[model samples]
Target: MLAKVLEEPERGEFFARREDEAHSLVNLLQAILDYASLSPSLKRRFTSALIRLSSKSGRFPDCMVLEEVTRLGEDPVAAGSFGEVWKGSFYSEVIAMKVLKVYERSNVKELLKRFSAEIIIWRQLSHPNLIPFYGVYYLNASKTRICLISPWMQNGNVVQYLRREPDIERSYLMLDIARGLEYLHSGKPGIVHGDLKGENILITSSRRACLTDFGLASARDSELIMSSSTPNARVTGTLRWQAPELLNYEAENTRSTFASDVYSFGCVGYEIYSGEIPFHEVKSDYYVMQSVTRGARPPRPPLSLCQTRGLDDTLWAILQSCWLKDAAARPTAEYLVSRLRAMPRNAEEKTTPAAHGWDRLTRSRLSHSLVDHPLSCSAKVVQEWKQLSLFEDWEA
Candidate 1:
């Protein structure tokens, strides 16, 4: 049956058959190893064959050879607990390669399993606001150095980009993130972005914001809580952006909900507006966690600062609602998107009439002054001043 399926020209059928064969082969090997001991030579040969077949089974069809990738830097573009991200060139296109760190030999199997899972999740997601996954590749025959590839964002992460262009409008950035979260939450079972922070939001070459780093993400129905006994399963999200409920022992059994994500979104909004990490003054993660659980909120940026950036009271109110103590009280990602969508229109409406009225009043006063101050100046000079005022008004 496998041979016949492989002979078929249809790509879908071929892949389906390959997947079935791979699973059957794995089960057979496990059974043979456990209940029937084979000669070491025979077992090794079988394992090697299985590995070779699996590599070409189209699981990650876009997987590239080591020769296809060229590293552009000695140092990684970003680094964290899981791995290092390096900028590289793949087929003439700049790509970000995330290389997972290999630890002890005993843990390699588990790490590879996790890496495969991440790949599967990325394949399932498709959104403009989410980072685009290109393919996966191994650096050596040992398969020890696995790298996940994606398009590299030239502008870097949100925090870095904002620092460089402090005057850039952030409403669109916040809206992009909210749209990504909404898409994740709207999936069949819904995906919770367990880690949502400014660092995870990348700025694209087109100046659009995209969400990345899904190492901690999980389906809402199967959310896992970090336990002391399972250090590997511990929550990897940053303390500052974590929801208060995530810090409570009693809530461990409770799955992370859409509300928790909303809480994190609020923190990200603060970071985007203030150009500072949430709880920037806090010295330690533990302290930040404690303060969050105790209901201590980050201080609001001064109204003058917010106003200067076109952020008004209505937007601030939305941010406040996001951090409400009761998760149920927090607005949904969809709702936030709608509010953000209407914000620019709201600003325009509020300012348009007032600005027009002020302009009209100024022109009326100037016209009256020109009439009353008749021959105090030469007629040619007055006519020139009148033409200049008209030109300025027209330009405005």
Candidate 2:
């Protein structure tokens, strides 16, 4: 089947099939099964072949990421106090390598515990959208370096994706991400992402996104989340997507509960619709938190626009529910996915003014990006997905 796909120049990259890919995969046998009926053994062979293909992505002492890794350096992407990230590869698969540098305050033992925990936790997580961990290595010395390997996305990150084209039907793509979240929330201990924002979400060659950088997923052991000693530490998350509860930094953020992630997802939803950072119009995280805490809801995606386009309100409601200030309020990611899938696909309006209901949010750059598209509206979902800043445009 893959050979057949290779026959077509467009589908030649058979190994790049992403479970959440925006486009159809023609090459793999399982993909063929998805396209047409096939025998079970054929599927087995396909899986075996893919494993071999995937294995080749990372292996060797002098791999690209390994060679490029340094004791102390600038972040290949960008830097925050959390850690310094680098772009690297394993086998041949591109990976975003992260190395947290040590400091005077760095507790070698505690730091190691947390860093090791990050890798160990990811080792057990496997989902289409939850980025997988290939391996980890440390340099010997007081330098105290910890490197984690994750699948690299040709595109940069989710925030950049929205900046270029915000009107795409990314809600479906979010469904895939939700599955990963559901898996995490359904685990034995039920992992808490601690941090969930656009920068941590990455896009694959196929334009499907995977959640990465789990350097802070530890769950809280707090009896009263609002009773933390250090209120300032709670502000560690990205300000743009700050959840209301994250404002107190210490006291209010006492518990890194599942609800906190939901709150973050709500802010992400806002980013998706507005094509701008959450609270970009705001002065500070504290101010944004005030609005969210007081139910200062970000304007909803225009119902007229949504209705005109036949967008799913149920799904939109699910996205909005994540914004609830009470950390105990949001639905589980699994439940949200279920509701989204059950939604009718009848609301696909083909023609309409781009500036109907979401006039304030949808403007020149965003609407213009979609106006000239030559593919199906669904095609635009991915058509523009690749065009987004995170990944190189694939139209060529």
Candidate 3:
């Protein structure tokens, strides 16, 4: 029976068609193993073939598996286009597990490819400003659900952390973000963070901003952005933070260049300074796309807005230069960091909390009103409750 199963032309043909189909014959082989007491040599041959087939099948190595991980709760700490992030504990360490959403069998193959690609890229990156990746594993026995594990940022995403600790300096946050980008763009074949925005930036317990989510990242040499023929090259990042050239959809602009990242960095600056997303007033992403393609930008925050935030005019000027219609005119990430470093620090910033008194008052009132409420309170409020001394640590 084992010989017949192995010798079947149709079985061999099916397995040869795609590596993904190799597992289809596993059940048949298992049944044969139970019925026929195979000889040691035959068993060895079968084991060797199974090992070769496993490697070709794209299963992550055994080292990547988490023998046990305890989910904290049903609520996800964060959510994104690809998955929801839950806080979990593995080997006594708290980690964030991003569970990819389920898809039809037809699309599962492509999703798995993407998940594997993300892991490969993330594992190779090691930097202080880049979020640390732990590993990835299958969530269940069936192996249909995959989860990416990474260190949990206690402070959460940049925007959320900022809203909570309004006293933190915007320049410091911006500087951290710039440094992360500088690292990504400085390597031999620099990496392009295709999707960069406030949400993608996380704040570590040390109050440092770290970059994460490399699902769309690509090596400069690979030039995933350079080829317009590829669907991913054309549309992958958030429209609000995307460079005008990227929005133009021109064959040349379709290539994601470091210049495009600089443009998105500018939008991040706008978010940090104004406390609002780029084009927050705009009703639709389509409108923002149209406006950007025409050389229109999010209206500059008034000088008063900058002053109120304790931000120098030079920083605002840098943002303007970043949004220059010509991609070549935009300053490189390295230049932006240097310019930001040269800006003078505010005297009041040393003593004053970064947030205005009114903003503090408003938040305090909201917190008080929601103190007794459970479901009515937002995730941020719940987080605040959990970390009662969070503000004290920030002040320290």
Give lDDT per model, in order.
0.64, 0.52, 0.65
Rank by TM-score, highest first.
3, 1, 2
Model 3, range 325-383, lDDT digits (tens) per residue?
Answer: 99999999899878766666633333533221111232223323221232222344324
The model with the greater lDDT, 1 or 2, is: 1
> Which ranges in model 2 have alpha carbons more than 4 Å from their true place?
1-75, 104-107, 139-143, 164-168, 219-235, 239-242, 248-253, 301-312, 345-396
Estimate, for each residue in 1-396, the C-alpha lDDT of model 2 and write its tens digit: 233322232332443434333122212222332243535444333333322222222111111113332332344676667676777644334455676766654554456444544554565566666776655545554536667655556566876765554565676556556766777777643566767877788765555667777766642222211121222334565655656666654563254567777777776666565555665668776677677767776666567766543446665677678877666767877777676556655133213111211112222222232312222233444444454432243332
Instruction: Show the colliding residue pairs in model 3.
Output: 167-354, 225-255, 225-256, 226-255
Candidate 2 Cα RMSD after full superposition onto the native fold (Å): 17.9
* Candidate 2 accuracy as lDDT: 0.52
Work out how many backbone clashes candidate 3 has.
Answer: 4
* Model 1, position 44: C-alpha lDDT score: 37
Residue 217 in candidate 1, Cα distance off native in Å:
1.0
lDDT of 3: 0.65
Most TM-score-accurate candidate: 3
Angstrom error at residue 326, model 2? 3.8
Stretches off by above 4 angstroms in model 1 are: 1-67, 221-234, 345-396
lDDT of 1 at 47: 32
Model 3 residue runs over 4 Å out of place are 1-63, 222-233, 250-253, 346-396
Give per-candidate clash totals. 0, 13, 4
Q: What's each prediction's TM-score? A: 0.69, 0.60, 0.70
